[model samples]
Target: MSSAMTNERLARLYDRIEIQELLYRYARGVDRKDWDAVRAVYHPDAFDDHGNYKGDIDGFIASLQQRHAHIEQSMHVIANCIIEFDTPDSALVESYFITYQRVLPSAGDARANYFLREPLADDEAVQGQAIGRYADRVTRRDGVWRIEKRAVIYEVYRGMPTIPGGRLRDNWTISSRDGRDPLELLRIELGLGEAR
Candidate 1:
C-alpha cells in the first residue's frame, strides 16, 4: 500500500478510538454527575431524546441533574459499540449499556413507590438495573468529534430493595464527580506525572 493509504487508514483508526472514548466519557460523566464532562461530549446544538425526556442538550442536562440528584450513585456499563461512517466527518454510532442506580427512599413518595413494593427500612435503599442503547449521530467539527444528536432506548429495567449493609465502609479514596477517581493510582504506578 502507498504511504498515503496507510496514513489514511491510521487516521480512521484514531477517529474510531476517539469516538469510543467520547462514549466512555459520557457514561462516566452521567455516573459521576459531572455536568461539565457531559457537556463536553456533545455539540453546542445537540439534541437528545432519552425516553423520559426530549429536548436540546442544555435542557437534557438540566433534567438529568434534577432526576439524578435524588439517586445516591449510578454506574453505566457499555457492553458494545458499533460505528458506521457516513463520511469523513460524520458517523452513526450505537452503544449498548447496562446501568445500575442506587437511590435513596427520599427521592419522593411517588418515585420511591415505583422502586419499593413495601416501605424501605431506614438502612435499605432501592437498586435499579436497566438495559439500554444509545443511538447517536456523531460529527466532526473543528477537528473534534462530538455527538450531534442522540436517542436512548431502554430495552428493560427492574428495581429491587437492596439488602442492608451492602455498601462500602470507610473507604477514603473513591470516585468523585470532580474528576478524582481512585483508578488514577495506575498513573503513579506507571511512572507518569500526577494524574491531572
Candidate 2:
C-alpha cells in the first residue's frame, strides 16, 4: 500500500480504538458512580438529552446521583457503536447502552417484607435490569476526542416498580441556555440554597 493509504488505515484503526476506550471509560465511571470520571469523558460544554436529564453535564450528573440512589447496584453494557468520521477531527457516534438496575430494599422495608431469617441473604434484594441506547455526537478537541452531545433513549425498564426521588424533577426546570449550575439548583430544590 502507498504511504497515504497506510496512514489512512492506521488513523482509522486508532480512532476506532480510542472511541472504544472512551465508551468503556464512560461505562466504568457510571457503574462505579464516579461522577468526576464520568464528567471527564465529555467536553466542558457537553449536553445530554436523556429522558431523565435533558440538559447539560451538570444536570446529567445531578440526575444520575439522584436516580441511581434507589438502585443498589447497576451495570452498563455498551455495544454496536457506529462511528462515522466527518473529518480527522470530528465524528458522530451511535452506541447501544443497556443498563441494569438492581434494587436494594431499605433496611426497614427489607426487614418488614423480604427477611425470612435473622440475617438477609446476599441475593434477595436484587431487582432487575433496564436496557437503553446512546445516540452521541463526538468531537476531537486538543487531540482528544470526547462526547460533545448525547441523548439516551431507554428501550425497556424490566424491573420492579420505580421508587420516586427528588432528582427526576430537578432537571425539568433547567433551560437550554448555558451558565446554570445544577448543584445550585439541587441545593435550592432541597431548601439548602444558602451557601455553606
Clashing pairs in 1: none
Pairs in clash, predicted candidate 2: none
TM-score of 1: 0.84
Q: Considering summed lDDT, which 10 consecutive residues are worst modelled in model 1?
A: 175-184
- In the range 1-196, model 2's lDDT, one tens digit per residue, is 8999999999889988898789988986676666776898999899989774688899899987775664555568999888898888888888888876555555334432322344544434545556777888888899898999988877776544334231246648532111134554565679955332
Reference-based lDDT, each prediction:
0.82, 0.70
TM per prediction: 0.84, 0.69
Residue-level lDDT tens digits of model 1 in 1-196? 9999999999999999999999999997898777887999999999999887898989999998988876776889996899999999999999999998877656746446437476656656688898999999999999999999999988988888774233667655555443465554564567852544
lDDT assessment of candidate 1: 0.82
